[model samples]
Target: MKKQDVSKCALLLSLFLAASSSQLVHAEEPVSDTASNLATNVAEKLPSADMNSESSDINVTTNQLDATLAPKAEAITTETSEKASSEASQSDTMAQTPVEGQSLNLRILSTTDLHTNLVNYDYYQDMPSQKLGLAKTAVLIDEARKENSNVVLVDNGDILQGTPVIMAGKYGDHLGLIDLEITFQNGKWSVNKDKSHAQIRKIDTKSELADASIVEIAKEAHDGTVAYVRKQVGTTSAPITSYFALVKDDPSIQIVNNAQRWYAAKELAGTAEANLPLLSAAVPFKAGTRNDPSAYTDIPVGPIAIKNVADLYLYDNVTAILKVNGADLKEWLEMAAGQFNTINPSNKEAQNLVNTEFRTYNFDVIDGVTYEFDVTQANKYDKDGNLVNPNSSRVRNLKYMGKEVTADQEFIVVTNNYRASGNFPGVKNATVNRLLKLENRQAIIDYIVSEKTINPSADNNWYFADTINGLDLRFLSADKAKDLIANSKDIAYVGPSATAGFSDFTFTYMKPDQMTSMTSTGMSQADRQAIHQLAAKVYKETRSSGQMQASLPKTGQKQSTGLAILGMTLVGLVALFKKPRKQN
Candidate 1:
């Protein structure tokens, strides 16, 4: 062969090989619509160029290039296919065995402030009110339980002190509390005789009553009184009143007087004492040990049982799992501390150490953390849980699990929905990981029944700091809290409150010696009397005499007319008896 012909063949061979390799690369890759069209055009032109070539040498060079590259192209295609299959098989294996590391699935449920709505029925309206109740929440809890095996339920307190059921249980038959001797006279409810001084009926458990007719009557009266109060207040959220008149006719007024007398008697005798048994029954979960079992000592081996006389709390609040940073947690503690008022030591007047306006439901005594409130400083937040003063810091020495919590550190807060709501200051922005929509009361009940026991010992994670050496702080609570206050630490029973329903107590911050000088300075005798008089005036004004008269028995109408005629005759006799000298 000629040298130039050989060189031409070599160049043709290089061009053919390069074109074939480019086509193979394009075929291997996943092409888009545009790339596929470009590849098709190149494929069509390459075959035409081979057909148009008249040189036999060029055709021979192309044949040699094709033979040499065919095996290499086949090997490349096979390798690409095997690689894809291997990746698909690996992805399938990963889908089958997904277990990675040791991890736990935990759920926490919580409910709060249920107010004794065990059933979804409203006793006051005499109908069903599905808006609030444990019965409806129970269904949500059941659904959650099926999904998770590990679950913990907790209530955030305030389960007691609401609803007609609690009132009925506390006061027994409401009619029995009224002193008048009631009788059905002339087809109407009427007072037959004065029974004001008599203890007409002792308030006891409903179970003890043989004839419950009085209770039924009392329920009706209570419902009527509540409705009347609601109407007068112009809202359905009126606070419950202990005393109100059923009617205002001569006989009905006498009945009201008798009811007041009964109320006074009960107050003097301390009716709250009667409520202890019922309260205990409603909240029966005990946390601490009953009797210590010591094998070495003479003490009997008592069965391990939950028996602590702590205040019975209903389990209506569910448990909640929250992810909170240290800064937010500190902010929450400060908001909780807003419940207490900074005592003014310079002022001699008996000042309330705690803000009476702060609702007890908003007070959160968080467990599993040690913290204190320095009441000397003002709260960072206000009554509405809004940040008002950022400079003030009330929360002091906040620690979780014996370590100081850093701002960046994250911790779990087990709380209820009320606190978790946007209205609750620091908790508003918290990340809620889990919510078990369970009634706290039922959760506690179930825990007791399932665990067969509980240890009701205080975790001692929360307390008020005695930073001020001799600061005199005072708070008013139920009169029945005298004994509890006497036994408690850092607190002393100062004296009885001038207010009828509550008692006053002085709190000593690390200075028990100064407690002697901390006299109970609450509402003064004069102040109390003035308040009572004002309350009486308001009550009389709100409760119209005409409304009471309209409710009076129909049988009393004739008697009332007779009394009016007798008054007119007495006036005439007085006028006739008067001498004519008075005119001169």
Candidate 2:
């Protein structure tokens, strides 16, 4: 072959190979679309010389190229077409197959702040309310579930307390403390033994000695560890009154046994809230109520009924959880510290322990963190969370797990929706993790039912710091302090005050460490000595009332002291867990 003819053959071969590669790259198209176009392109590009010239050599080379590449092009086209078809089939199968880890859709249902309205009925107005009750919410929950096959339910708290309906029935009769009139017979003082008779019915002095003295008789009555003598029921013309032994657990006997103080203790509400997410809680309370001294709930500890739950949590606030830093936690405590009045450490005259102007509900005690308020220093914030005294700080030794809480250390705090949104200092701007659908009261009830027997004991996590040095701190409480002061190491009965139905109690604030040992199960030497003096004083007062007698009552004939049981009940509260949901 000639050199020029050889170069033309090589160029034709290279062009055919390039066109085939391009056609295969877009092989999804029909074979007829490009296969004929490749042949026509090579023929057009050849020089058009007449019969026996150099162009005839090019034409011969093109004919030779077509012969050499035809079979190869046909094979490439067939292979490309089959591969495309197979890929299309595979894609169709893939589209129809179920994914192993596909996401799903889920719906969350919630209700909160039921506030003792378990049913639709309202006791105060004596009518059924459509807007009330957790039962009513069940229908809505069902509808929500139907909309989404995957669903979850949650509650935010504040279900137990509030609503006069909860207070109008049997639970309304809070038999706080029972005063049993015991007489010394055969050198042994005795009172009623049966707890049922001891609580509702009056002490039958006529009956034989069940146990020695009021304390021993009270200890034998296992129905409740405490007894309270409710001074007077609100506005009842014929209110029952009695003198009952104020046992340690008896809320009515103490001068200050209200929901605010009771739930603030670490054992009851604190433990319940903490246990939900296994985190700390910052529970708040007011210093006073609309009813003041008359507004008190004292439920017995024996059998927990529906009415008892109402006495514990006194609100309709929904539960909430906030993620806050330790510094913010401290600020929240500062706002709560406004509950107390700044005391002059050097003053000898008695001063009020609490600020009467501060609302009780605003006072928050953060459980799981050990802290104290130095009442001697002015409060850093007012009840409304406004910075009152910028230079002053009352919260001292704020700690978590025995270590000082760092400014940026994060913590999850359980609280009600009211406090979370109320713009309280440190808590107002907190990052809310969840706003639950559950009521606070219902949470308490659920917790009670699960535990069966609850011991609402104070862990003494917080207290006033060193108020006993030369400061004659005093606070007003129920007149029942006369019976309870003997056992208390921090409180001294200071006689009846001018305020009707109230008494003056000297607040002998002890060091936190001293408090544990002094108020322990076993009495201290000082406690023993104080008890002896207090016993004589209580005996003389009893004798003066003409209630105590040396002679025993006629055998088997029970005597009524005109003391009726006061209505009291408690409810548990707070905390809910998150349910896993499908993403859809």
Candidate 3:
């Protein structure tokens, strides 16, 4: 063999050895740039003279090169296949590993119309009650927080006025006085009068002492009258006054001349400027000097709290979750719109805005939907939330997330138990998914404590649509809401309303162009007329209850002719029965 051929053979052997080592070790690092450059240089250096040499020498060199490289190439192929399979397995394992970040547990809590039952006590019955109060709800809130890491709480207004303590705080000395006059006689205080022998007392219907017995009255004068006065004036702050006078006087009995000042001092006891000493000495009941305290035990005082209106308003409502279809949601919106009266476009002078019976708390303001109330049409529900007119479509163009709401679409509404129990319109058949056992106030407090902070602004997800003829429709709200209305984007302040304590604001209603296209196919004029008549009949039946008479005279007219005849007959009888007087 030639020296050059031998050198080529040695070089090929070294290349084969290197390739074998690389495959055996399964090297993952790529070949260095320097090594790659050296390989390229060696390939270029292969002599051109050798290529033109004898074909036999070229064939022998190629055969020897192929024999050495063939095994290394096969080993490399097997190792690459194994490596690829292992890498794919590792990728699969990595995919199964959980991604690391914060896990979210969001919760929303709401309380509405909590009428001040802070301690679960009924002042009227003068006993402890379990049915209502925020204290009972606090336990549920604590439990909720333990289960949920993230929480948001909100209150739905109407909180400031409910209990007797609240009323007393709001109205101070204006709670007027009770006057009782007694004369000390025969070692006791007795009713003093030159007229009738019966006990004389002047009591007003509003007077807190109207139910007080003679024994209670005598006891009231002996002491500073604090306990009696507090007992008499329970939850209401109505202006009431009473007078009692005594006729006889006795040296053994003590008479309080300035009873008003004495009672005032006692009633003011526990306050900053209370005269405790004077209050203590005001009422000093002696055994015989005053009437027996036990005698008045049977005479029960009228209920201290007025039913529903005053402090008697209880906080028994609970939070609930309602699942309903789009149709039900639309019906509810229509019922809420019933808070307004129907407007006649032809009669612009008619003030057909908010209904007189509409209550602010009863009118629910929902978020996350856009809708408009058509005032030209009658409400589907009456003021009592009864289905008065099924054909009436007051709720128009209801859209969720800018798309028209479909009848088949489902929605969830967070509402009070009263509303969920079918007390309110539109949810009579709704499915109740959940009921939060916590009281609303406590829930709100817990949510705030857990969240640390909250966003107070409304989402503005809904608004009234503009009227068809561009006529502005107005509604009444608190006069103080003028600032809010002026700043509002959807409503404009129109000035004070005819009703006191309320100001009127005009809201945008749906324009004719913006209204949803309602189609009724295969309906002839006769069918439409029949439907109209049916709707009218339903409205009259549900709303009026047949008590309304079409031919009844105006309320201002004379009620009956028989009463006039009876009055004339009585006057003639008196004249005919007149006694003739003789000269004395």
Candidate 4:
């Protein structure tokens, strides 16, 4: 053939042979980028002129090229497919490796509400407790760290006296052996007058302790002293005072009641009510030392200590300010009034003044408003703030500064975060104007520190309605309450109660004006009519069973008297105030 044709044929044959020879020798595979570059160079080198002149020779050479490289191409394609499958399998293995977990194990060590119990010792009981103290927890923490290289330790606040008094109250009351009534004098708990009722005592509330998930710890710690149960989740502080004393009907002994009100009045009286001061109120539970109000008693009208502050404000609830209308404010008090069971005027048998099911912590008394709860009528809301008796009107004579509160009139109320967060009926729709950084308990402490001396005297802003003229109500309180009960017309101290460390007291219904407030107990025309009808109905129903079976929402009943009072209609009130309840 011609020289150019022979050169073209030689070049094509050499390229094909080189490719085939590489595959035959099992040389390193050419990467995709390198193979693409080689093909581009080979195409550039082939001239169009040479291809035209050497068509016949190129056809003969192409046949030989295809025959020789066909096997190599097949082998290369097979090997490529196998390599791609292997790579795909490796990628899948990597993707699934995370699901099998890691080599290192992580451990978390945590404790909370230590309450300054650093040593394995009980300061109040004067005893050693192996179950409490950070020192005891340290050993376990070290063990945890040693077992796992990846470990974290965390403490969840409530240091010092920031611990809640309600916890101590529940523990003491449920155990029924801890002396919550022990007074503070000379920087120590006052010695029990009755030697048998000592501060340090054994507790056997097995069911309660177990339900609390601290039975084992309590058993180990309770050595003739208050339980010093310590665990990772929750811990208890030393009980310094009575938790239930704050909610006592006898405002005289209610140190916490006046303290909370006084704190709000002094610190949280917002600028909105500057012309006419705002009221501070909270719904604190009566956990212990519930008593009768017969005689008046003061906190010696002297300087208060920091320790006493813990008794006044029991929880860690932060302060919150709510701008509410008079109507909703009255409704708030009505929800609080649910703490008391309806008192049947006609019932002769002894009836409980306070609803045991209704937690006393919900009974809110506005410091600036004078209100009376007519127990003769049904409660408007349940303990959870559900409107059970849509037509029932229990809140009566609700007035601010001797004037009847109007629906349109706005007022500021000082309360805690828990109360302000739409937890109760009247307060659910109230606008939270501001939330303060100070906790309720811390505020009380600060107030005492600022004042140095405080007189926690109740203004008797709230009381029961005088409509039940002569119903003798019976309530239980700590035995020490007997000393404070003066022989008054309204209250009479009964003998020791069957319950250990408790006493019974008889309280007769009387006018609020007779006791504290000079403001007349005037009733609206609607309240008078409702009261008359209720009295008549109770008289008829209670005569047979000596009990007025009023369908109160708190009692889980669906029926109610639906009595209308105070001209405050309940139309659309439910929809206006309904909100999702939160767990405390």
Candidate 5:
């Protein structure tokens, strides 16, 4: 063979190999319809080169290349094209909704202030059977998404710590404080000024106050940044700030996740404005409403009548911790701190307790008239904030910037069920007719119980707005407090007749805490000792207001006085203290 012929054959062989390899590379690649069509047109116009004159040496190479590369390219193109088409079909199906002509039936399912209820696991009940775990709630959420076209799940904040999950270490070591990321919707940005505004003072913006808050802010932000970075690279970082951190940007998950959020978040498909509907809790047992706690469709807002609330319980979540108008956030936090100390001072996380949201008990002004609750009898001071008597019933004052308020005025008073059972100061005699409940307390738990997953939110804004300030401390449940009656053994107690008189009297009952309570001021230790002494003093002198032995033999069976008795005859009656105990 000629050297030139061999070289030409080698060159042709190289060109053929290169062309075949290029085709193989594009086998599974997505082809643009326009480019493919143009290529087809150009291929038809190009003159075909015949290989009839090729030497026998090139025949083997051509056959080998065709067998190895041609089939693979055809297979890949068909497979890639099919997968893309299937995905498009699935997307279309998901877009379709049950309601025709309706846009996405976007029911934003939000669980506000769900502090770490990972187990649905009610620690109070102290049983695993009563599990209110988010694991179970996720089931309901899954079913909800099935029913609706677009279901956006949201958590309204306070997600850091609450339940036994705090002790349930992440990876069995560090606190399960997850550090989640923010995913804001388009054209909207969040300015997290929670730390900066917590210390805001309105009267003087230029006050030379020590800027200790800036240092606190830097520390928190720095920690948050580190957490996010560690999570991004899948490093095992300690003390994740919240539960949201665990599942954020998880490539393993094809859905969004945000468990530590407090504010209302809105997500719009296009440039349309988004308005999330506010939640108004409908209660079954409000004052002036037949005193029933099992009625349905009670609280209504606009056209939406809230029904099916039989199993859904109401908590004074809104007004229990902080009021919106009466005071600053600091006041509410302080009050919450008080409540925590009162409830469980020795609690390990007492400093960070979030039992309830504090509410404001603001007064109203109607037609130039201020509506104030009568706290005169409730006040324990002698006009100078001086303690006149320990047992005085101190009412919470209602004033508009230091000015006294009058009745018939309007105000948005914040409170929770523990106080709004119509048994707080100033409003002690008031019914619970003037309060509005926030979201149903049990709905979020239900979601967690039925659905094991949380619908992730895209917003970074969060706040619970504690409302615990200005409200009197309630030592008992609403029923016990409202039904307070004077105990003869209770020096702080007012007689039942006083209550019946509707005068300054209030119903008193034994609180579960065993501490005596009164509509009056709390009793001093000396005063309480005196009351027990008085009970002993009034024993024999206390002629039964009903019937007594005008002239009887001293057959003293041991009485409440614990005196030495002789027989079970006509003696000083023990006022029938033992309420007819059954002879077992």
Candidate 6:
């Protein structure tokens, strides 16, 4: 063979080896992703598309599945088969299979404790390839579900109290969820009022110690000592006020209610000149003690547990069923018992520092479970690398790892993802089961791009006492709503879950997550008519029997209030100003 021919043969062999080597790895063709880079290039030139929009084409789609199913315009499906990888290692396993009897399997993609990772959670790279966002993540979920028969998208929790996304939402421009945390408690060492009441007490919630969680209380002077549970994740410097959940005092209401008693960090820290804004409902030990609201050494604000945002369960826009996978049910009871055990009976002799209402101050029960969270210890890291316990051991609030023990029976627990990953240490890998990861994570964008129109709606049923502006705003946690869905077993309602997140708010009439812009109480003329019709249908079914509510989707609500309020306000103002004033 000629020398040149030999060289060519060697070159071809070298190319073959390189191709084979690719099978062992997913070569990060860092330069290949042109959309985001191009987008960045265009961003400075133009404006950013809606943050929720997966595709630049924010148009409508006739078939919801189309947009949800389509991959990126440039995504090569045939190439994917060629790209099927053995990315799974001993540490993690990845699998994909078509469900039996269906061309597509129902895909459920979940991400918990995102904590405001609107951008890639890793802050190293300030670009798309390095970030994980609901928008980018939405693409993955959309594609996976679109490729399968049915798909469910879920967010585990802590969605509102972390990162700039949440922080921006909370303080408007001043703060976000990522900026919230408890700095100090002023009265952590306040002395007990009397000997009979004791310095501390531990109580049981009617459950086994091993099978239960506990609640503890530290006694202090007066009837209105405040107990506060601050937002664990937010601005670091932000001070958390103590709170009390109020419903236990109201005997007339038999139903569940979450109220609060607010205490400033200064009071908990045993300091005067208290700079913390003590916006709470804690009456002074003596009713007339707090005469000033602003600079008064003492005042009252919230008990944090108050349903002031709305009526009990109404904050979710509807009543949601909660499912807790408790092992013995007595475990929580034991935690309470531990608190009752801390009572120092001798404190009863104090002349001025007697707290007469100590027994009355307890956890606001949901169903039968009661929990009193430790605000101070929550921020401190313990030797075991867990949140330090601020409260006495008798009453423990936070659960890290196996401490609080979840039943894992597959139901909602009314908590955000931060607590799910044992408080966000890395929950995605905590308990892996049958998880359906998205194929491209951008399939929804492709589907939406494939079609032109979009209908964002869900079938979660949320019956309530009434609606505001003709719609209800009360809501339940996603966990509770899910219970009403799978186990509610109402033959009337089909596969829909029961939820409270989407009452009077305007929903897209499609999936809650799919909506680009929904009002707080998604009830537009378009949505109102739709929700009204749905509410009417579900209401009728609920009245008929338990089975009726079972058929509805438990997650019909979307908490995204971005455009819902604006849309309603604009429409209302237009209607108000557009009216021709009557000529007298």
Sort every candidate by TM-score, greatest first.
4, 2, 1, 3, 5, 6
RMSD for each of the candidates: 36.9, 36.3, 42.9, 33.3, 32.8, 30.1
Quote the lDDT for 377 in model 6. 16
**lDDT string, candidate 6, 1-584, tens digits:** 22222222222212222221111111101111211122112223421211221111111111111111111111112112112222111111112221222222112223432233332222211122222233343344344445542222223311211211111111010111010011111311111112101010011112222101111221231112121111111111111111111111111111112111010110122322122111111111111111101101111132212111111121111211122334322232222221111222233211111111122121212221223322111122222234344343322432211145354432222221222223222222233212111111111221222212222221111111111112111111112123222321111111211211211111001322222132112332233323222322333333322221111112112222432443344356445434232221
Q: Could you say which candidate leads in lDDT?
A: 4
Model 3, residue 55: C-alpha shift (Å): 99
Q: Candidate 6 overall Cα lDDT vs. reference?
A: 0.21
Off by over 4 Å in 6: 1-253, 257-309, 317-328, 331-345, 348-364, 368-584
lDDT tens readout by residue for model 1, 295-362: 00010122211111001232234444456777877887777676666645565545455554454345
The prediction achieving the highest TM-score against the true structure is 4
Worst 10 residues of 5 by lDDT: 195-204
lDDT of 1 at 105: 28
- Summarize candidate 4's per-residue lDDT along 1-584 as a digit string, tens digits: 22222223223323332222111110011111211122222223333211111111101111122211111111011123234334433322222211111121222223443343444554333455543454444444444455443322223311212321111111121111111112223322222223212111112222222122233355544542332211111111222223223223333223344344444443332333433335577554334422211111222233343323433454567777788898888888888877777777887766666564566667776766677778878888977889999999988878765788898788777778887775677787776456765676665554344333343434456677777667667765566666654545566777775444556667776665465432122332233223323333433332332332221111212223332221123223322333343221
Ranking by lDDT: 4, 2, 1, 3, 5, 6
For candidate 2, what is the lDDT? 0.40
lDDT scores in order: 0.35, 0.40, 0.34, 0.43, 0.22, 0.21
Q: Could you tell me how far off, in angstroms, the CA of residue 39 lies in candidate 2 after the best superposition?
A: 99
How many clashing pairs does model 4 include? Answer: 4
TM-scores for every predicted model: 0.37, 0.44, 0.35, 0.48, 0.20, 0.19
Taking the tens digit of each residue's C-alpha lDDT, what string does model 2 give over 1-584?
Answer: 22222223233333332221111000010111211122123223432211111100001011112221111111111123234334433322222222323222322222433243444433322344443343444444444445443332323311122311011111111111111122223332222222111111111113332212322433433223122111111121111111111111221211112222122222222223332212334332211242133334444335554434434455666556677887888988898788777777776766776564566567665555678888889878876678979999888888765678898887666567887777788886576556554455544544344334454434455777765465776655566536645666767877765444456666676776665454322322233223323323333333223332122111112222221110010111111111232221
Clashes of 2: 47
State which candidate, 3 or 4, has the greater lDDT.
4
